[model samples]
Every structure is written in structure tokens, then in C-alpha cells.
Target: MILSYTNIAIKLALGLISLIIVINITGKGNLAPSSAIDAVQNYVLGGIIGGVIYNNNISILQYLVILMIWICLVLSMRWLKTNSSFFKVAIDGKPVVLISRGKLDTEACRTAGLTAHEVMFKLRSNGIYSIKTVKQAVLEQNGQLIIVKAGEENPRFPLITDGTIQLQALDSIDKTEEWLMEKLKEQDVENISDVFLAEYENGNLNLVKY
Candidate 1:
């Protein structure tokens, strides 16, 4: 009986060490969920707890098997997040337009599963007393609402990014290679090769050095 107990203890220790490493790799982000899928992950984490606590009955092999399954599920979700926009929406719900053109869309609110009280709370938190001040309100997939006031600064487009001169991007913005070279020269940058990243924002090319 003593021998059996010692073996069980060893298994429990090993299981704990393995679990700690797994949790670390999976990340603390899983702990604070922003979506329904995150809620499901928290629930599924119970299996790890169960396996570790019931080490006498659950073998090390069984623990590994379950953990592998969990890892695969997480990786698959990440893959879907990158590959399919539809799947991304299914796991992390699509953003809903709460207010558009100074008009509140009650249907969008209902679809986002947010109560009127919650919407008001979010707005007030953003220091918006009246909905009229909001030109656009978006309920982001992460359960955060973004409010854009009328006459807000125009969103800037990025061009010539990531150390590579983006000819297409330059063409899209109606800029030529000579213009880019001139901008680079003004920044005291001799060549594009020196730039780790370059982007045109607000009609200016911002360059990052290597």
C-alpha cells in the first residue's frame, strides 16, 4: 500500500509540473476571456484539474492524451482565426455597429447581446452624455465598444511598410518612386535598405531605422 501511495504521489507531482508548463505555453490570455469561446475554454480547463487531482485513477498517459486534445483544439481555433473570417466571427462574434451617422441601431444592440443599460454604461464610461455626439459606435469582437465622434480625425492609410518599398501601395496613394526617395532623403536616410519599416501616414512617410 505504501509503495502504491508513493507511485501515486510521483504521478501527481509529474502531472502538476506538466500542467504548469502547458498553462504557461497556452498563456494567461486564456484566463481572462473576452468571448463565449473563452468561457468554454475556462470550463474545459476543469478537465486538467480533474486529471491532476485524480492522479491515482487517471494515468500519466491519459493526462497527456487529454492535454494533446486541448492543444489541438486551441491551435485549430487560432488557425481558423487567421484563415476564415466567418469562423472568426463564429468563435469571436462579429462587431456590431451600435450607432451610425448619429443614429443608434437598436437592432445591432440586441444582436450584440447588450442591454440598453450596458450600452449607456459604455457610452458614459467613454464620457459621452448624449448619443448625438457619437457618429459611429462599434461593438468590437472583444466586447469593447468604440465610439467615433462626428468630425473625428480621418483614419490614415499605411504605405511602404515592413522594410519593403510597396510599389502597389505607392501607386494606390498616387505617389511615385522619386517622391519616396525625396521623402527618404529629407529624413536623412540615404537608402531604403536602411529602413526597417516605412509607412506613409497623414501625407508623410514615416521611416524606422534598422
Candidate 2:
């Protein structure tokens, strides 16, 4: 009985140590979820950490090896995201405009798989009493709701991201590619592929190049 208790204690300590190392490698950002990927990672890490502790068949050595492999994968993904915007969008997803021009965009809400009430709860949590008072509310990939309060600065939405045109964004604002091309021409950026990110804010177009 004493030997069994000692073994369990040893396993517990091993699990705790492995978890700490894994968390350090993954960084606290995984816990604070700045993207949908991070939020999913948090769930995955939670299950792995708990499983390592409770699963009797999982040896301490085996658990540590598994965690190390997972850490490598997460780190690799982060590195790739920094270098490739297309990969970033594929993994994290682009932020959706949930509320546009002081109106709830039900289509965007459906795309985000969140209800209007849920968005309202998030808004109220941010000290917003009424959704009507918002000019825009974007559902960030990290699950954050970015609000443009009424009478505040004009809401900015992505026009182009990672050299890809956001036709939906342009359609929502009643603009066309010809108009976008004209604006880009003014900026001396004649090609769409030259832009890394473009946002329409305050009735003006701001673009960044790769």
C-alpha cells in the first residue's frame, strides 16, 4: 500500500512538472486566447494535462514525450503564422463584422455561429447598454467583440487582407473593385497583390504593403 501511494505521488509530481514546462513553451497567450486557434488550443491543452494525471495507462515518461511533441507543434504553428498571412487566416479565421452601421448583421452572426443575445451579453460586459448605440461590432477571431460606439471614430473594416480582396466587405459598403483600384492607384499601388492589408476607415482607404 505504501509503495502504491509513493508511485502515485511520483506520477503526480511528474505530471505537474511536465505541465509547467508545456505551459512555458506554449506561452500565456494560449490561455488568454487572442485567436480562435488559441481558444481551441486551450481546450486541447486542458484535456491533455488532465488526461496525463488521471490516465493510469499513461506512463510519466510517455506523458512527457507526448507533451513535448505537442509543444513543438504549437511553436511551429506560431512561427509559420508570423511569416505567412494566408496560413494565419486559414488557422485563425478573419474577424467578422457582426454589427454594421448600427444594425445587427444576422448573416455575419450566423457565420460566427453566435446568437444576437450572446453578442449583446458581450457588449454589455464591455459597458455598452444598447447595441443600437454601436456603429459597428466586429467579432474577433479570438472571441473578442470590438465595438465602434456611436459618435466615435468611423468603423474600419478590412478591404483586402494578405493580397486577397474582401468582396463581401466591399459589397457591404456598396463599393466595387473598380473603386478600390482607383483608390489604390492614387496610393501608387497598382496591383492588388502588393497590399498586405487594407482597411476602409473614416471614408478613407488605408493600405499596407507586404
Candidate 3:
């Protein structure tokens, strides 16, 4: 009985240490996951550790091997998400535009799996009582609602993220691809893919290049 208890204690310590190491290696985002993948990884890691901690059949060596394999899989996925835009979108979907030009987009609401009441609730939580007062609203991948009120100092949504143009953002701002390309040219940016992030506010295109 004492030996069994000792083994459990050892397993608990190892599990805690493994979790901390993985979080540090991955990023603090795992602590408060902002994307579906991050949330899933956290849940799965917890489940794995919890499921194995009490099992006498699974030796410490086997447990460590399982953890190592899981860590490698997570790291590979993160690497792919970083290097490939398609994978990033596939893993963490792009933001959905819920409101544009002071109008509600029911289709977007449906796409986001949010009902009218839920949208209103979120807006109300943000101190927005009237939908008409909103100039633009986007539902982030993390389920947070980002609002740009009417007559505010420009909108806050990004024109480009991870080298891809956001068409919804452009539509919200009443801009076009041609206009964006022209602005990029004005800023001496020869290629769209060179930009890591681009935002338009107060009549200026701010760029972060890779």
C-alpha cells in the first residue's frame, strides 16, 4: 500500500512538471487558449495526465513516452499553423463579421453559431445598447466580440493577417483589393505576401512585414 501511494505521488509530480514544460515551450496562450486548437490541446493534455496518474498498469517509462509523443505532435501542429496560412485557417478559423455598416448580418451570426439574443447579450456586455450605434463588429475565434462603434476614430479590424487579405475587413471599411494594393504601393511595399500584418486607421495603412 505504501509503495502504491509512493508511485502515485511520483506520477503526480511528473505530470505537473511535464505540463509546465509543455506550456513554457508552446506559449502562455495555452494557459488562456484563444483558439480552438489551443483549448483542445489543454483539455487533451489534462485528460491524458488524469487518466494515467492512477493506473498501475502504465509504468512511468510508458507514461513519459506517451507525454513525449503528445508534445511532439502538438509542437508539429503549432509549427505547421505558423508556417502555413491554410493550416492556420483550418485549425483556427478566421474571424466572422457579425455587424457591418451598422447592419446585422444574420448569415454571419449563423456561421458563428450565435443567436440574435446572444449577439445582443454580448453587445450589451460591451456597453453597446443599440445595434445602430455599431459601425462594425467581428466575432473572434475565441468567441469574443470586437466592436467598432459608429463615428469612432476609425475601425480596429485588421486589413490583413498572416499575409492574407481579409475581405470581410475590407467590406466593413468600404475598401477594395485594388485600393489596398495601391496603398501598399504607396508605402513602397512591392509584394502583399511580404506583410505579416496590415491595418488601416485614420486614413493610413500601418504595416508589419516579415
- Which candidate's TM-score is highest? 3
Per-residue lDDT for 5-123 in model 3, tens only? 77788888887887788789877634678798889988988888889878888899898888888889888888889899988889888888898878999998998999999999999
**Relative to the true structure, how large is the alpha-carbon lDDT of every model?**
0.69, 0.76, 0.86
CA deviation > 4 Å runs, candidate 2: 1-31, 53-61, 79-90, 110-113, 125-133, 149-153, 157-159, 166-176, 199-207
What's the TM for model 3?
A: 0.90
Error of 2 at 83 (Å): 6.2
Best by lDDT: 3
Better of 1 and 3 by lDDT: 3
Can you tell me which runs of candidate 1 are displaced by over 4 Å? 1-31, 155-210
Q: Considering only N, C-alpha and C atoms within 3 Å, which residue pairs clash in candidate 2?
A: none
Give candidates' CA RMSD values in order. 7.7, 4.7, 2.0
How do the candidates rank by lDDT, highest first?
A: 3, 2, 1
- How badly does each model clash, as a count of residue pairs? 0, 0, 0
lDDT of 1 by residue, 1-210 (tens): 123666556656755655466567666532676677866776786667554654556666776677677767866886786566567768887557787767888988888888989999999999998888876777766788777676554222344443456553454355688998898899998877677778776666677788
Which should have the higher lDDT, number 2 or number 3?
3
Worst 10 residues of 1 by lDDT: 153-162
Candidate 2 yields a Cα-based lDDT of 0.76
